[model samples]
Target: MYRIAFGTSGWRGILCEDFTFENVKVVTQAIADHVTAIGERDKGLIVAYDTRFMGERFAKETARVLAGSGIKAYFCKRDTPTPVVSFEILRRGAAGAINFTASHNPPEYNGIKFSPSWGGPALPETTGDIERRANEMLGEVCYRELALDEAARSGLLEEIDPRRTYLAELEKKVDFAAIAGLGTVAVNALYGTGRGYLDEPLTAHKVSVRTMNMHRDPYFGGFPPEPSEKYIQDFINLVKGDPAIRLGIATDGDADRFGIIDEDGTFIEPNYIIALLLDYLVRVRKMTGAVARSVATSHLVDAVARKHGIEVIETPVGFKYIGELISQDRIIIGGEESAGLTIKGHVPEKDGILACFLVAEMVAREGMSVKRLLERLYGEVGTFVTKRENITLSPELEAGYAAKQHQAPGEFAGLKVRETVTVDGSKFILEDGSWLLFRKSGTEPVVRLYGEASSAERLAAVMAAGKAFILG
Candidate 1:
């Protein structure tokens, strides 16, 4: 039997092979047990899904399972974004949320993301308990399911649409008036739950918005519903062909990760976007607080923080750690290199809709394309180049990787290793301000090699040296 394990985000598996109805029940029951044990079951939980295959069916089944456990289920009426589910959990003061989404994963995959009462992704200890409970119940009849009608009759189920409330919340955090002044903004939802969540707010604010992939398609236009450069070529082409479109914004399957294209149709890296947004939020918005970023993220953010005289909090490679600081109002913004981000006074989860709108507002008010703004930032703070690669290891290398990671090298690509950081992985900070990180994927049999330097050539050299170190 396949073990039901929760990774950095959640527990994901192939739709029919491992993420079957029975497995979903087992996981849901495990979550129910965890909630009950924590004494939070009385407050109830939010059950939501993204626009994936059989999404609603899975959500309904989840709600039935919650109801059968004699726990209240605040069921979302339709497919909803991950951040919206987090918003609803805090808005209603509920126990937590069970979000059925695989985020940016491919079509054949689905996942269960559990958030506790703190309105962030569940921590490792909590997920570990749930995993232990789920594994124990794998072969047993783990869950009791109630009919939807019976669940409603017993006052255990309540259907909700979080769009309006979530949008209203964004309206408060983002300056829609500034974005409305822009000539045109192009958006691509990539045929996921972000369709209305990303576009509707713009329309309501009287912004001239052009959108694509707004319809529901389980196949996601034959590509994964990720908004990254490789997965969103059509949107890139559309923006490139149109001069009127000043900015292109896209959101992944669950609207928790953002992708940005400049007026020149250049896909801005998330590392740079985070740094630019951090600068904008502090300099223009006059927001004052420390900033948080994952260790894998570019040091450009740190440069910006130093320029603004704010401290930087470096965390492990998970939004949940950053979310913890956000929940406590300890940081003005928190982001990761993987396109996940959240701000203060918002849901303690990544909100791509908020990030997109904030970018629009910054562009409109600054009167510059994203590229120009990036260039300006580079001139002010020193330039930084970053890259990440997923490298598959041979069986022999895979077996020895754990031990190798512990032995920090003295030099890489001729640069002296100044320090080693083990926040999330083995990261060697070189003498010249460049860094390299090697992290094994929790869910896949691959290692993520991340490198950053002051120049592209240096970044390439650093990455090559990292690869060589792994291979040797």
Candidate 2:
């Protein structure tokens, strides 16, 4: 029997392998039990999925399990975005939400993401309880499930479409009036759940927009449904080839992560986007609050907070920590370097649809390309370059990785170390304001190295030195 382990997000495994139907039922039952224990079973739970193969089937199965456990299930009529699911959780005051999505992972992969009543990713405590229950019931017919039709007849299930209400919420949060006059904008759904959410609002506002990959394909056009720079070169080419295209925006499989392309065909890094948006929200929108970012994120956010006379809260690698602050109304924005972010007034979940719209509104109001806006921000608060690399470790190095991170060097790359931070990883803040972080994976023979500096040249040197230090 496979141990049902939940990672930073949720339990993910390849289809027909560890993520079989039997396993999903076990996990759903575990969740149902958890809800009962928490005394929130009467509030009902939302069931949603993305555009992956067997998505709706998996959703129905999950709902059946919930119904069998005597919990009402709110079923989405179509494939839904992760953020939209979060919105529904809060909108209906549901007990929680069970989303069947692998996020940006490959097509062959599928998983479950659970959000509690707070409408953010479940913390370790919740997932730990579910995991323990699931593993205990493995390999036994330990779960009961109600058929979809039977559940509906008994009022244990209700179908819903969240698109209209979700878009309406966007109109209130985003300045659609500003984006109306912007020139033609390009959108790439990447064959995921972002098709209507990202493009519909712009179209409804009378903004000229062109969209690609609107049709759903389980294969995701032969690539992982991620909007990263390397994975979205076709979108970059589209923006580069057309002078009429003012900007390009994209979202991942579940519409929880965003990617941006400048008018001149430059792919803006998410790190820089976070910092730029942070500054824009403080200066233009007049929003007042501190900001939150992952420890692996760029410190340029710190510079922006400094300029605005606000605080910067750094959390561990997961977005859940940042989401907690958002729930508490402690930050104007919270972001991860992995392209996830949410605002203070929004649901405590990453909203790629919201992120793209914010970028468009910023461009419209500023009357400048994203590149120019970045250059302008760079001038205001010194420049920063950030990079992340994964280094495969040999058996010997892997065995000693833990020991290496604990022993921090006083000097690295010929620069004096100013501070050593061990929040999520071992980060050495150099005297020159540059920094390096080393985090080794517990399940894999690899280490993730993150580096940031004031210049590209310095970043390159720091990355190399970090790799060397890890190997040695």
Candidate 3:
């Protein structure tokens, strides 16, 4: 039971392991208690689930727990995207929400994500309290539960479909008019909850869309429902083979992270996408504001901000930090290298559907291919390349890192260390404007090495040096 710890996102664990129904009930009760303590129990909660196995059941159980606690549960009727759930939280002015999703994790895994009334991931302070209370109640099994019908009869459970309202909100955020002019787009939902949320909007806007893997699949087609390059190859191939398809977009299991493929079948890295969109938002849309990014993200965004004379807020690794900026209207856009992003005047939570639609709008309004647009941005802001790799840690290495004994070198990859930023990890900024960051994973015996340089070759060299430094 103590193994049910929260990570950067939430308390995720393998099904039938730490993520059992008993643990879910315990965590749900903890959340209910926390909400009640805050005097928001009357506001009710929006409960949703993704396409993972038993996600609906887990969500229903969560609602039962909330109902048993004398709180109302506004439950989603079908698998709902994370962003949609977040929007519903704000729309209904609910106390908060409990979402059953593991995001991009493998199918064997499922977890609960709790968002506060602000419609963003719960911050550390809130999650920490819930974690402590849940662990304290490990073997208690003292929770109230009500049947679905009874909860509804008692006016504690209300079924809802957030799609219509969520899509209406999205229309105001994305430039659907521009996207309607775009000839064709391909969407790969990865058998997650993004099918209707991402693909339907484009079709509704009169954009010709071809969708793949839109059906619900508990196995996620035998691959983790991550919208990264490795997992989205078939979608890339589909777009590449079709001459009419102008772009390829995809979302993870819960539709909060995005993956993009250019018209030429290039898998544009999320770092590049963030930079490109920052430039687009600033230069094209004339949206005036600073930007925020995680420390592990690329400095290309900084280059764009510098070019535009806009401020850049550097945050820790989690989107929660970035989301904080969005909530405060401090940034025009907030993004991470992990393909999560949300913009100002929107829910603070990451919205892959919105990200994908905005890219389409960029392509249409610019009247150029995504590759060309990227080249244009490079021509203006100069070129920047970034890479990341994970190195497995031995027991000794893990202990050394835990003790903070592993320090950045005076020089790396034949460059002098100009500065070091320790906001989230040891980010050594080299004299040549390159950087190497080493961050330890909370749940695994591995260190993530991030490198950014002026060119691909330099990025490779920096990554190699980072790997050598960590392994040594």
Candidate 4:
């Protein structure tokens, strides 16, 4: 009887809770209903799931519900990334794609993300429509079971191989030869969906590629599968333990977010990666195009783009905005602070595999370590460090706190707040150039605080002042 609400990407919840088998069936029926109403029922639906709990069963239920509703459904044969399954939708020109992946959330969670026929994420307007349809069908799904033999004969159910199409797209967009030139690169995938995707590309490079933690254990080792600094600190330590491993690569669950550990074993932030890639693509590769990012992303990219006389487009927060910009021919590369990214001629979804190879290619072409590349990038622009912290608060308390931040803070750490932005959250930019942005996490019961400054001390101060505001 639970009405579904779409989060950042799609509907997600704790497995066996709001994400029960019953709810999935209802959601599938809603999707099928929407497609049928829009006159695309014959276009069919594609379904896939990750390695989360009961993911296979969830996908099967989704397909069964869709097929029961007289909508053709082609489900994935095995575990797959959201991006990979999304690729299959476009490859087969299906009506839509439904992927059972919570996408970097804690192991206790599982969810679905839908892709439209364009193969990009279902845009906000369409997602809103789906939500309406799903809520209407809530508790009304009494799915009819179709025998496998009958379903196959009806030509409404099939199993698909989801990898080949996405891999082919990767080969076209990424410069593989550049990455191959790196003599030795260590790849430690953060136990997410990027496991096999990284190997084939690197193996063809003939470079010494070493990988770890590729197993798709659904629990994610008792931690969230996010590719944040803390989540991938193991890879950071691994790189620090060995000087020969020049670059470390990782991906979040579902293989959309990317993590980069420098040669010095420092976890470089995604904002920095965005700026550096912008510089490399436009300045070095002579790729004449603009860069785009969410407003929460570092200003370093804006700084870099201005220096090169290129353009930088800023969105509110979601990759959907950035993806739309890419589709509209506004950007050549798009990345967010949270590590979601995409590029021109690529699927509108963030791709960890493509991001990994792009950075590796930059290192090989420049003949510099990620650490050194950052140094040079900083030398040209300026040095910056960013840190983020999450504070748990009840929804009621968070709503009250946000109401106060809407008008902005008067001061922080003896410096007057010169600017305030409510783009995604309340971002108080102090006159000293230190900044703090407080926003509620869309996926969890926590409020994320992001701070950036030129020094560690200032960054700490920013965090402290921001924490006081949030907790107060």
Candidate with maximal lDDT:
2
TM match of model 2 to true structure: 0.99
lDDT, candidates in the order shown: 0.92, 0.93, 0.91, 0.80
Query: What tens digits encode model 3's per-residue C-alpha lDDT throughout 235-340?
Result: 9899889999899999999999999999878898999889989989988989988999999999989989999999999999989998888889899999999999
Task: Give the candidate order by descending lDDT.
Answer: 2, 1, 3, 4
lDDT at 343 for candidate 2? 92
- Residue 261 deviation, candidate 1, in Å? 0.6
How would the candidate models be sorted by TM-score, starting from the highest? Answer: 2, 1, 3, 4
What lDDT does model 4 reach? Answer: 0.80
Q: Which stretches of candidate 4 lie over 4 Å from their true place?
A: 142-145, 394-399, 442-445
Cα lDDT tens digits, model 2, 1-472, are 5799988888999999999999999999999999999999999999999999999999999999999998999999999999999999999999999999999999999999999999999999999999999999999989999998999999999999999999999989999999998889999999999988988889888988988888899999999999998888889998999999999999999999999999988999999999999999999989999999999999999999999999999999988899899999999999999999999899899999999999999999999999999999999999999999999999999988888877767877788999988889799999999999998876589999999999999889888889998998
Residue 406 displacement (Å), model 2: 1.8
Error of 1 at 209 (Å): 1.2
- Give model 4's TM-score versus the native structure: 0.93
Residue pairs in collision within model 2: none
lDDT of model 1 at position 356: 91
Residue 70 accuracy (lDDT) in model 3: 93
- TM-score, one value per model: 0.99, 0.99, 0.98, 0.93
Clashing pairs in 3: none
Question: Which parts of model 2 are misplaced by more than 4 Å?
Answer: none
